[model samples]
Target: MATVLGSVRAFFAQSAYSIDQENPGDVVARERLLDRAMGEARFRNSSEKLRRGRVPADGLALVARDPDGYVIGTVRLWNVEAGVDASGNAVPALLLGPLAVDPEHEGKGIGSALMRAAVTEAATRGHGAVLLVGDAPYYERFGFFADKAKHLVMPGPSERDRFLALELKQGWLGGAAGVLVPSGRRFGRAGLRKAA
Candidate 1:
């Protein structure tokens, strides 16, 4: 049987597309596509503010490639301490953002494929929740909802309605109320090794 990613690609008639762990060699194309997908002003967004100068979470960055090996879509999850739990210890969560598809690839299921792969990979790696600042309508389908993040705060200004969260592990958001702070861990060029 074909994989779910393949199913999504088939749904969008994108059989030549594939999502894979990001290789450092794709950085330049990723950056160019990001610039085109999000534009230069994207730097001012709240999510960008949080990720500034920090590396994405270990093994959480992924890219969607076309048949020719070009990076056509990208989605990354960064490590963030959502807040304290009932025990007063930091609750680790993933911050998903910059989910971009190349302009030429828009209208295809590339973006959805990237989101599905990123979240699935994150959960498989033992993360409990994912948070993001984005369109409620677009992300809600992926289980992102303002209510899920009602108790948390971003590091900078953001539209209250657009900030959302999804709990891969049930109850991960309950009492997860606090500032979203970066985990401060460095991600090297090698990207973290995938979980065996």
Candidate 2:
């Protein structure tokens, strides 16, 4: 009876250890995860559109990795500016999007972690705001909203509700309003620099 109880305790201890080893704190480590998560469909579609001499290379790319070192999610930002706002300020903003999480890991907080990291980085780099086209409910949790309606617009048609922005600093979008051009010159030298 004593031996059986000891063995049971050992089994339980090993199980706990295994679980701990499997769930290390989420971290962003590399760009490969973004490439892999983008996959062919994502690459051919959204990525291709953004990469077409438009998106800036200087923008940021981030990923969330699990304890096993597997990339579970990703987000990217691009250099952009908004038209003059009510205050007559030319608001330079960052376009945020293409946030994706592994299907198997969708509900595990990986997406949120990636978003938090990107937002923090953008703020640290002195960006005014981060914009995106996504669900209001999901993004709202991260302080994204439609407050830029008066001064923000996308180059192509986009649902008004889906268009959103988050200010990293107070009055970041003051006096800015206009079409959001892809960070590059639609593919010129500046564009090349952005895509680099």
Candidate 3:
């Protein structure tokens, strides 16, 4: 079903926009887009607990740009420990969040494009699984499901049914259980100063 929907989306997706790796120059525009799409409530999301002061996984921060070169969409993935397996070994996973597309571009498929790009990049980087707290109806089309994520938990409050996961490698999430913890590189003072 996911595959079929993916093909259908691909068939109708517009080509006027481009998906690209997020760069320093895109930071401002991306943040503005996110603010408009999610408002102040975005900062209160459960995923923000894992992402605050942490850099996204290497090469996993992405943006969708319009033909005019403006950022129209954004999505980022952060490294997280999806708890421990039954035997106690740490289970590494990527947490995807704040996927937002500009309101003007909402129906252009930019969000879906950014989603595919980020997930594809994670898979290419050999990530085991990707977790997200999002609407199941929307994200499930990308293979994210609650079944595998049932045993995993995030730091803050999140609807159990809304927490979802997609295993890039079959069985990578098998036996996984525990609270998600940030495992990505910290946003250091230097980076903070630069952003400032």
What's the lDDT for all of these models? 0.83, 0.61, 0.85
lDDT by residue (tens digit), candidate 2, 1-196: 1122233234334331111111113223323444555555555443235445564324355555555555566666777756666766566777886887777666766677667767776676677788888889999999999876556777665778888888888877766787775553465655544443
Position 94, candidate 1: lDDT: 90
Expressed as tens digits, the lDDT of each residue in 1-196 for candidate 3 is 1222244235434577777767888989988998899899989888999999988887777777776789998888999999999899999999998899999899877788778877877887889999999899999999999998989998989999999999999999999999999998889865443332
Model 3 poorest ten-residue lDDT run: 1-10
Task: Report how far residue 158 has shifted in candidate 2, in Å.
Answer: 0.7
- In model 3, residue pairs whose N, Cα or C atoms come closer than 3 Å (at least 3 residues apart or on different chains), thus clashing, are none
Q: Cα deviation of 32 in candidate 1 (Å)?
A: 0.4
Best candidate, TM-score? 3
- Candidate 2 segments whose C-alpha is farther than 4 A from its true place: 1-51, 54-59, 85-90, 184-196
TM-score of each: 0.88, 0.67, 0.89
Residue 15 in candidate 2, Cα distance off native in Å: 16
Q: List the residue pairs that clash in candidate 1.
A: none
Give the C-alpha lDDT of model 3.
0.85
lDDT of 1 by residue, 6-46 (tens): 44445545576877767768878988999998898889877
